[model samples]
Target chain A: MHILIIGAAGMVGRKLTAKLLTTGHLGGTPIQRMDLVDVIPPHEPQSEIDIHCEAADLSTPHTAPALIARRPDVIFHLAAIVSGEAEADFDKGYRINLDGTRALFEAIRHTQSYCPRVVFASSIAVVGAPLPYPIPDDFHCTPLTSYGTQKAICELLLADYTRRGILDGVGLRLPTICIRPGAPNKAASGFFSGILREPLVGKDAVLPVPDTIRHWHASPRSAVGFMLHAASMDTAAIGPRRNLSMPGVSATVAEQIEALRRIAGDTAVKLIRRVPDPAITAMCEGWAPGFEASRARALGFRAESDFTQIIKAHIEDELEGVQ
Target chain B: MHILIIGAAGMVGRKLTAKLLTTGHLGGTPIQRMDLVDVIPPHEPQSEIDIHCEAADLSTPHTAPALIARRPDVIFHLAAIVSGEAEADFDKGYRINLDGTRALFEAIRHTQSYCPRVVFASSIAVVGAPLPYPIPDDFHCTPLTSYGTQKAICELLLADYTRRGILDGVGLRLPTICIRPGAPNKAASGFFSGILREPLVGKDAVLPVPDTIRHWHASPRSAVGFMLHAASMDTAAIGPRRNLSMPGVSATVAEQIEALRRIAGDTAVKLIRRVPDPAITAMCEGWAPGFEASRARALGFRAESDFTQIIKAHIEDELEGVQ
Candidate 1:
């Protein structure tokens, strides 16, 4: 099976590539070749699988068909401008996130007669704040941020493209991937994990919001799981609209801290420091608290049960390198 | 005050133009100048108001800003490929519905010191199939048709553009306008009014679906009311996202028959012939049975209370020329 991973330089893309290579199969289909593309080509993964890396910028008019020439069977499109970047720079955001993504879809559509199964990496940012209760699978998307707006726009394009039979696609709206590896990043959600991940290694981390502030999350392992399952599924069941809200664990900052304490003792808990930033707090206020991904579960997609398991998954999967 | 009307040759456009000219002011703003453009030139409205009519197909490139040059205080953009034609032609649907709309938006954004209240005539097709019982104001949009997808996509663009301060816009998802003035039309919903209108004039009409079919509806008067109100309202109350699901009456097809029974007696009923089409039945099955337009109502926008009011509206408003 030939599998393609767009945005292979990003965190999830690199990890997914490494994970797919070792597994050899996704949902039982054996992986023989892996195609990777990004503005910056991905590094080599030490594995038995054949890997082809290409440097391409999708926002450019001509890059689509060039990437589509590989003729991969399954494609995981994880390329996107991060939320902060997209929100701060409107032109760059829509150009890369929206147009670039559309170009990729158009490229895949014109590639040969056979359509590949596309696993699009959508985000919870697609569903922003001022929500009603726990957002169900059927809630209206009222995005407040530029990033959210861009993502929501892409979701519509994906749905319409799939409806037109241009591609067999499934978009996974991933929750904030908690306990993100390597260090506290610049993401708005960085603090949430920072308060947990940094403290585990006895490093001081800031808390931008009150402990009561809640949000939904999934582990990186679950993200890979979502891509794998989306690749394997029969899209006929999804009908014309192909995107799915991936399952997530809802918790506040305190709940996240409690999970850290439970798993790794007081050493992990001591690293958390309270330093509130009103800017971040105000920004997060409009975001939806949680999601009820009943449809995804019904379709056999899964996620960690709660924060503790999410932390457990991270430790077992990510912290092994540290040890 | 300057007013621009896109798609000025369409049925609603003609009616709106005639109505505007007869009443020279919208909410007391004198219609000093009226600029209109469509694939064909608009009919000359019989009034003292200055009417500048232009014939230009919006699908062609670089024509959007040419309309914007007039720089009207209010712009009523009612242009789009109709449902039947849009479904029949794929490329044409995306071209006009999506790209053309985007171009118009971009055109307005590039205007020098240009800011106008954009009154967008969206449709109930934006929300299709598998609705909640008496669908709430915030119900999700799962459009089953390409026409619905296009309108929904434009709504997002409107919201995003509004957020970026490019334009002050209001997208009214008008319920299927009943008593649509004109001869037999191609729209599926046209049959609803056709069966009633043609029969009232002693002509036979086909009722394709069973009398059990229920749909959301508003009169042409209500639709006109929505645009006028949208043009004048304090869009700040609407915040960044300016589109609203305009209030509408939900009634069964049998109720339509009963309303006919109440007014014009059995003569109106005798003109109707029942025929079943499985295609329409399957199509209607997924349609939203009803909608709860709380936001629009909360903002003082009102649609007809019932089908009786809808029929009465048609008689009072449309019958102006007949007598």
Candidate 2:
């Protein structure tokens, strides 16, 4: 089986690509070829065989058909301009987030003779804050931010195109991948884990929103699992509504502290310092807490059972950098 | 106050334009100027000032800004390629329904610093077949047709823009205008009234759907009323979610036959010919049976009370056009 992973250099992208390579392929077809595409070509794999790692901005109209020429049986798209960056920069956001994503879909529509599973990485940001409790699978999407709006609009387009038989598409709107393994990036939510992980390792970190503020989260491992499952799931079951909220833990800032104390003893809690940034606080307020991921759950997607496991996964993966 | 009515040559457009001209302006401002825009220019009306009837294709990008330069205080956007035409011509549908509408909105967005009350002529087609009875105000839009999808997307953009204070917009998703006050066009649902209408005035017409099928409807008078009321509604009270379902009646084909029988006696019923079209049946199956237009009713947007009223309205309005 030939596989393509757009945005393959990103954190989750690396994990999913390695996992796919390890498992090799579906139904006994080994993934003989792998196409890794990003704005910057990722570090070359240490494999003897060929692996196509090309650096090109996929937002360009020509990029999609070029990628489609690879004829990937499974296309894992994890590329996007993150929320904070998107909100701050209108042109860059719309360019990469909206036009780029749309161009790919359009390319697929015109190029593909046989529909392939287009596994899209959506985010819970698609559903905005101050939401109805236990937000149902089919809640009306009222995104509060540009990133969320872009995701929601793309979801609509995906559903419509799938209905038109353009491509078999599924949008997995992932919860924020807590304990993201990397150096602290510019993402506003980076502080959620930074405050915890940094303190656990005796490093100071900023706390943006209050500990009492709530959010939905899944670990990086689970996000990769979601991609794998979405690739194999029966799309006919999902029908025209191609998007689903990926399962995740709904935890408040207080819950994170409590979990830290439970998993790493009181030392982790003491490492956390209280400081508030008004901008981050206001932005966080517009986000939703829990989504009743009924549709995704029924379709056999899984997540960490508890926040303690989230901490444990961090300890295992980033601590050792292991699968 | 000034008013502009696009598609002023169409049935609803002409009625609404005439009504507006006779009624004068909203908010106690006399409509000192009127602009009628269509591909086919409207008939010149004798006004002390001037009646500006312009020939233009709104689907092109340049035309919108050029039109908006008139800056009519109340703009009634009734220009559309209709359902059957839109469905058959994909490019034209996207060009007019999606691109044209977006261009118009963008034109409004960029033209100086005036916020005009844009009364958009949306349709019940935005909501496909509802599984649950009484489709609520916040039901997820799962449009089954391209025209519906385009309209639904425009509604979203309009709400977002209004929330951003870029435009004061109101969208009215009108129920199928029953006994549309002229010889039937090629719309699949045309025969619903045509069988009775064409025959009542001594002409043969087709019957395309089953008697069991039920759908929401309103008369041309009500459709015009919807436009006028939408144009004048307290948009500040409407808030961010500006698109609304106008009040309408739910009636089956059998009820329509009964309406014809009651209003036009046996002659109207006898004029009805039974020749079913599967294509219409398929299309109609994807239409909403009824709507919970509680919001519109509460806000004072009125439509025909029942099928009998619909038939009577048609007889009253269409008598002169009849042979």
Chain B TM, per prediction: 0.95, 0.94
Best candidate, DockQ: 1
**Each prediction's Cα lDDT score?**
0.82, 0.79
- In candidate 2 the C-alpha lDDT for residue A302 amounts to 97
Predicted complex 1: DockQ: 0.68
* CA deviation > 4 Å runs, candidate 1: A321-323, B321-323
Stretches of candidate 2 above 4 Å error? A26-28, A112-114, A128-130, A204-212, A276-279, A321-323, B46-49, B199-205, B265-267, B270-279, B320-323
Tell me the tens digit of each residue's lDDT in model 1 across B183-287: 997666678788767866678888889999888888887887888899888899987657798998888899988987787688778888888888877777676
State residue B216's C-alpha deviation in candidate 2, in Å: 1.6
Provide the lDDT at A81 for model 1: 85
The stretch of ten residues in a row with the least summed lDDT in candidate 2 chain A is: A42-51
State the displacement of the C-alpha of residue B68, model 2, in Å, after optimal TM-score superposition: 2.9
What's the DockQ for every one of the candidates? Answer: 0.68, 0.44
Per-residue lDDT of candidate 1, residues A1-323 (tens digit): 99988899888898788888877898788899988888897887777888888888889988878777778888899998888888788789989998999898888777769688888998888765577657888887777777777788788878877887778889899988887878667777788777877776668888889888888888888898898889998777876656788898888878888888887788778777788889889866766678889899989899999888887787788778352
